[model samples]
Target: MAPHTHIKSVHTLSPIDPWWKRNLVTYHPTPKKSRHIKVPWWSRKCAAALQAKRHAFAAWRKNPTPPLRQRFHYLEAQCKRVILDEKRLAWASFCASLSFSISVSQAWSFFRKMVHPQPPLTFQ
Candidate 1:
């Protein structure tokens, strides 16, 4: 058996080829054009309402109860419940916003496809 020799060479080029060509890979990222779609007024209103409710509950919890700390504990529990409900409402509003964005994107894509379509080609 003979000893194997390793060769290292580097080439410098004027203009570099695109990443896809150099790496021999193609990547198509999801289009972000949907961000242009405006969110619904109702969704914004609901989110605002939930935020306000959460803030109000927090304010209510700030006041100290009398010598009976048990009452304060109960109020704290109530505050926690209110906060949880607000979080739920906020989550629902967020989901609504996401759905609205998805629908808008679908509609836009359909419209684009209708306007300009790829032509079919035949090979000899």
Candidate 2:
């Protein structure tokens, strides 16, 4: 038979929170998103080819091989072509959107902006 000892219980009084404070809206700040515009990948095939070229590059970096270099070069050319096509398409779309009804001043301004896009000024 084991001897049992009586345990003493202590009471704790924590400050009661007000009902209003309990329901108060708390703002949780999240990471700010980048303001830069995200352009779409040239094309699905182009994107895939680019990824493959990257893999080949990593392999070449690890061990310099003539075959890997050749493949990477070929894929690089394909990627460049795709990128050029995408750019042309986007420009075409933008130009098409400015219907005939657009004012001459507005069209001129749009054309000017397209020709020389003022880079966003950044203060370091």
lDDT of 1 at 95: 57
Error of 2 at 95 (Å): 1.6
**C-alpha RMSD for every candidate:** 18.3, 13.7
- Model 2 steric clash pairs: none
Q: Please list the C-alpha lDDT of all candidates, in the order they appear.
A: 0.43, 0.57
Which runs in model 2 stand beyond 4 Å of their true positions? 1-29, 40-46, 100-124
Q: How many Å off is the CA of 71 in candidate 2?
A: 0.7
lDDT of 1 by residue, 1-77 (tens): 33223312112322343443343323533346532323222243344444555455565567544533555456556
lDDT of 2 by residue, 10-115 (tens): 1221235333233332432345876633343235655666677678789888888899888778877886676567657757876778788889997766555444
Worst 10 residues of 1 by lDDT: 115-124
TM-score of candidate 2 to 2 decimals:
0.51
